[model samples]
Target: MMSGFCRTPFKYQIMKKITLILVTLFVFGCKPTEKAVETKLNYQSQVAVKGDWQVTDVSYANSDYIKVSLFDLGNTKCFVNSTWHFISNNNKGSMKINDYSCAYESDITWYINQNNEMVIKFLNGTKSKKVTTGYVVQYVPINENKFQLIEQADVLNKTQDIVLTFERI
Candidate 1:
């Protein structure tokens, strides 16, 4: 017996519909998403208040000039604890290892422990520690390329102090 013609319209139609649906989905799904990117701010951009200040000279009572240096503790993810060191100006000061207990905010206010009576707060959110007494040190710029350490706190009995100042570098 001879076979009859077996052309089926449904098969081709189904294939066409499936191909169209797949193409439509692929075209829409492969599109790149419209993303809004946030611009990362530079360290300098946030410290606008310190922009007018520069390091000119450092002085430490009962301490050597060469022993002071600025310490960057950013590796610990504590931005607020970044400090200014007052070491012997001739020798490089030792790198500080700070144990970070909490996150730091960009706005950091530094004060000296004059009379050894000031309470130093810890990042752990506990009560501040009482120091013996030291001059609260501040970095001030007398002018461009000239700076001075303003001592507002009393230095009671501490023999040495570390002050770290940070600029763009």
Candidate 2:
């Protein structure tokens, strides 16, 4: 009787181990491993956008009715003529607003994600990991020398894109 009790527990231990192994294998095996598809345009856009750029224009659909403050910095007009330096090697850059009243500069880290959106974060002298707030904008490349960062804003109770056109410098 004693031997039978010990044998039963041994059998249960083996069964538990088997069940655990199977569950782990099933869980891991079912996990999706497909990588995100990287399009040619993504690579080309990154290449096209890299280097020094100047914001030549900033326009919105209905600017006359709605006034927008961009990046919590200043008016959209302040961004015009701003200089942006995009270093592709580490995807780090700086933005300098040269508009007389809004003269400011900040360190930024940016990247073109798999979705073709340009994600940017203003470090503002802080570490990138410490900064949680960031911005994502539609990245449109007209040519190697020209690109647009389109950001959506609430204008007159509707969503509108504030387009910032950039030309390579």
Candidate 3:
């Protein structure tokens, strides 16, 4: 009778098992989670908004309110082409009107209010002649390239909330 015992083979087998288990654990742990991705998306939206953006669409929160196009408001050209440049660090920004006749730029201050609302203030009389300052828009992080914002205004002495869709430029 003869018997053979090899320490190397046994050790190798045990090491292989440990490695396989560790790899399985790591793979599972590294898998992307939906919640984590959503959180990251929210953060990216916040930073991406700190740059230039243009209004693409506009609508009122309530369907009862009338919808008006840039031209419908007596604008010769598209007023939705307006641009807003939000400074990166400083709480400052600028709004540019590009509707031909209303073409003008204004120095503005912006902040993410306590309610996470985007509040814009037209400073130094930069606001449009017919507009007023303190326009607060609720910030809705839709994605990296686009976001939705809503703000209430006294359009006709009645407070109405308007939703604006913006696209990064």
Best by TM-score: 2
Per-residue accuracy of model 1 over 1-169 as CA lDDT, tens digit each: 2333344566778999999999999999998995332333222222322333323233456433232222222221232233433222211111223335533322222332222221112222222233222223344433333334443322454444443334421
TM-score of every model versus the real structure: 0.22, 0.73, 0.55
- Computed on alpha carbons, the lDDT of every model, listed in order, comes to 0.35, 0.86, 0.65
Give one digit per residue, the lDDT tens place, for model 3 in 1-169: 1234577778889999999999999999999885211111233334668998998877754544554333223331343678888775666788777877667667787666445577666775654444453555678878878887776655556787667788999
Residues 53-143 of candidate 2 have per-residue lDDT tens digits of 9999999876766679887888999898999998876788999999889899999998886677888899999999999888878888787
What are the C-alpha RMSDs, in order, of all predicted structures?
19.8, 6.4, 16.8
Cα displacement (Å) at residue 153, model 3: 2.7
lDDT of 1 at 128: 25
TM-score of 3: 0.55
Residue 111 alpha-carbon offset, candidate 2, angstroms: 0.4
